[model samples]
Target chain A: MTGLADRRPEEDSVAMPRVSFTENLKRHVDCPPQDAAGGTVRAVLENVFADNPRLGTYVLDDQRRLRKHVTVFVNREMIADREGLSDAVGEGDEVFVFQALSGG
Target chain B: MTDAFHVATRKGLFRYERRNGGWQAGAPAFLGEPVSAVLTDPRDGAIYAALRLGHFGQKLHRSRDGGTSWEELEAPKFGAEPPPPSPANAENFEADMAARKAAQTVDTIWIMTAGGADQPGVLWAGTLPGALFKSKDHGESWSLVESLWNVPERAKWFGGGADLPGIHSVHVDPRDSAKLTVGVSCGGVWKSDDGGETWRQAGQGLRAAFLPPEMQYDPVSQDPHRLAHSGDTVWCQHHNGVFLSRDGGESFTEIEEAGPSVFGFAVATHPDDPESAWLVPGVKDETRVPVDGKFVVTRTRDGGKSFEALSNGLPDGPAWDLVYRHALDIDGTGERLVMGSTTGNCWLTEDGGDSWICVSTYLPPIAAVAWA
Candidate 1:
């Protein structure tokens, strides 16, 4: 069976998009800025969460949908699909996730 | 009998210790965070606290050395949705699809209870969205009790005070570890004879005045604000009135008269006597404040035949304190009881509600209180 340890070292050299989290979430769980490889918003977030699974819980609900008070913006435009998270992402794209100013 | 008690509040988890003939508050843990539930396992000295973060979702923490130190543990959560049914199986395809499509998440860990003495490392958690979870290894992990959640009658469950229905009371019968009774808001009472493998809707005589006249007596529609048990009898401070069930939870008889009003959210039953229980009486429905600006704790000793309003050491007039379901607790000896309210006032009774002393009046809105 193929495992993470068996992957080729060259695959790590590929360029990926940078994902950053809101400062408010740092108090609960850690989510430092990092680079992950993916083609869509869901894929990119999931890719980063693959290494830090606990961060995924802070951003998503049990149904794996983005939380009601969390918003994600790719570069400048906000992601259109909150549930499916199907917005496209390009190489070296800047993804910013922020907590909405709704709840106290 | 207990020297210490933990209070989960809107701001943090506070511990009160009986020191120098008075209860003293210690340094708060998780300061500036909302603690929804607190449980101190009687079998073991371990303490578990459930936090409901407004921004980061729900979290659970365990403290072994009282409340001095804590370790973060995975909170109870719902599992992934089940696979959709095939088109050939059209018996109840639409209903099945709709049920499956309505995804559920753990909005709040409303209550947590330690399993019976036989089950050492077991724990039970009831959460918002009306789901039960079991943890065999303390609070490290959890799994949904599908037997209770998948019941067909669960579709009728709806929200009461919160936006979604919540299971606020989980009572594990001391006589038998397998016998379990859980009280849900707007979902009536449910009993499981063989642990949580299966469940049945109980609480036969419960009535819901909020519903239409025709459905007032419906079993599944009754909203029990809190359920407390002592010995074989169960006491329920329902939304409409105070109901008592002598046979576990199979049936109930409403106590038509309880002090100034029969409506409240919290109930504390004596540990040794089934007929003795205490409830905080309040004006029901729209204005959930003290009846006529008089706050009192109503005690029934003659098995609901009569009740007395105990107000000594409490507020005299123009007081508004609404206690939540888990904010009232009785110690093992049943002599000492503590209660906190939404208005940040706490009272402690040393002589079983005959009188009470104000413990704290400046803490954040209290959610749950447990004797450690």
Candidate 2:
């Protein structure tokens, strides 16, 4: 099962993908990373939602653009632009995430 | 754990905790004259108290071993502090004085406690007339951010009567030290990306959906100035529901629409899950309560796309009342939920609003509840 046919990747992988990145979102009220699709920050996140429909609950609103508070990082670096997320991935890369939320 | 917290109320004092699913007051309550502020201090590692007297007259306190002991901090002797609300701003002085005497003040102090997460010993305060003040040296001294007071949105605040603002809740995200968001009651929400230097209303994706007449009711139309902004996306909780601001504060979209709990007071984003947050619905004007006559701590696990009432253990009696935004809070752990009510009691629900138990009482219908 090499994937692409399932809504959420459950039977696809023998090993979990690992990556590293830093979060630079404005508010720190958001955290916790979900699975990503590809190596690119956007692809990894899309893959995350693709594998876990529940992850879609946090990462996307009805409009499906990134929620205001949700940000994805690639290799410890934040991807400033949310619109273009079809980036490539590198093995052993670390992905960082952030939320754009605030409160007292 | 059960008897760890107590409160002093008018009808004596009461202490409570989660026994099973419902709440029950203690047979013998903690008796005192009642406290104005209930704050969890990060600096001293315990809860503290304070009493607000006009602008400069503040009586602060600390509980060394939690709420078990208390001591007052000497009020700073400001040699030339501006006179307390002078005759110039007091046409109805007597009435205003009376209101001040009856109304609770210091409890709106979460922002005033200072220092959390990355900020150590920073006292941030939001006040009526909607002003922002900061203290780098803890509560020993204070100085307004200075520029936030002069922001362009100031004029549009206060029914356009004055160019001042009411800084309701100053929340700094624990995850990101640079981000800060404060809400101004009728005006809207503002964000400080540069750590409170310059601020702009974050109104994108938010909707002031009070009908055209409501917008028309703005004593003054928001003068279309060149909104000095860098980004367009913003989120706001207006007199309306959760609003999303994809275009900063210029435009917005309403996210949650209860039948009539539109005028919500508290909106809390989830600590670990930004897509998930909690909001308490209140009456539009005290004439009625939220739907079902229950105080719901509704959660939207899917961001604002949907919301579900978490009132399984709340209430179904005459206990229903307005839950002010400042009155509600989630501890750093996000597992404990609390709110001080105008009904002279505060509540704690440990299991995500699955059930609620009064943690403290007789505290003159609490106006705010903050936990470190």
Candidate 3:
């Protein structure tokens, strides 16, 4: 019998990054987890936008830049590169996108 | 049913239909979200709802089948991040950056108005943080009207409800698409004669009692709580008093005798009768509730010279429900009027304010209402 952690090399190259949304964002649209195929954050978001195009508008500004209040995290690290969203993402990494609305 | 309408409340959006001399409430949409503004386009019969979610900031939804189903659309958002701190504020770049970031996020869409009948896909939205946005592809996409946003007078304006001032009313000329007027809370009314290419302060004669003696009559400092336009005249339920403009907002003169108290949030104008209007009077600004704890609606057929309190079927007991600016509306014929209060009650009159019927008793805090 083979365990999940035991299967490594062959599955590595094909592994996709998992993208999830906050509950707040989920109410606006049906955001189910998806395995995005991309090496960079921009590419991964583009893949997600491909499925729900309108979601991109809520997260991105007209100039195709991330809104000031919206934050994207890669494996619990807040994104530092906002202009291009070019932060690198590796296989099996979890990417989270959520709005940073503060106060009532 | 002769007419249909929708009411946007703190909890959701509800549609009301009049069938066989009775009114019915439809299933609520966006069931638990705070809907700030909602409008229906007369040209194509599309419904737009603006909601501010606790965690998601602000969002917009559109329904083509008259509120049966909804599709989320891109909300009106600032086009880009504020230009890097200007040379003047470069010394305090961090503070400047913080301020600019706050300006970009929309706290709410306070007002949504359909464009003229000719402009089928046109829609106008005034948002918190004091910006005006226009959509040309129906409600599909929006672009910020930077000309008005960049006006020099905007600096003097501050927030009335939220931390930043917001545009609460956008009135388009019934005759031309090129003419438009907007009422800003804390900021006075501004008008555009060239279809938003240029804007000018149009609040002359309106006084702000809270301002310094010398600045009391300064147009830009006057806070217009609610504004309505009918033909060539513009009417305002101001923070200080009721004001009327007879020359297309060129100037306003306070109508010193508008009953109960001049302070109110909701103002409605007859569709064809320029001199006819209605207002739900409240206590003064400090209290901002009903006067004497009684909910009364004042109507003026002679253009505010004198107002008659209309309370045929409304509560006369110790009730204190404040009507919001966008919560009062009149249908096209001006015979039917409806208003909702902050305490989750609505009243409707079908006989031009002669009598009123309680439409709903328990609803979410009403934010806005419009005839569909």
DockQ for each candidate? 0.41, 0.01, 0.24
Candidate 3 lDDT score at position B21: 83
In candidate 1 the C-alpha lDDT for residue B36 amounts to 94
lDDT of 2 at B251: 62
Off by over 4 Å in 2: A1-104, B1-37, B43-46, B53-58, B74-110, B159-165, B209-236, B245-252, B286-288, B358-363
What's the C-alpha lDDT at position B39 in model 1?
Answer: 93
Residues B264-328 of candidate 1 have per-residue lDDT tens digits of: 99998998988899999889877899999898999989899999999999998789999888999
What local lDDT score does residue B204 receive in model 2, on the 0 to 100 scale? 44
Query: What's the best-to-worst order under TM-score?
Result: 1, 3, 2
Chain A, candidate 1, TM-score of 0.84
Query: For candidate 2 chain B, which ten residues in a row score worst on lDDT?
Result: B221-230
* Model 1 fnat value: 0.57
TM-score of model number 3, chain B: 0.95
Q: What TM-score, to 2 decimal places, does chain A of model 2 have? A: 0.53
Question: What tens digits encode model 3's per-residue C-alpha lDDT throughout A1-104?
Answer: 12224448788667788787776776677777777889988889989999887777667654556766778999879998665687899987778887776522
Compared with the true structure, what per-residue lDDT tens digits does model 3 show for residues B13-109?
9999987788889899998989999998888888999987655567898999988888888889876654545445489967765665454656688
RMSD of 2: 25.9
Question: What is each predicted model's overall lDDT from 0 to 1?
Answer: 0.89, 0.50, 0.85
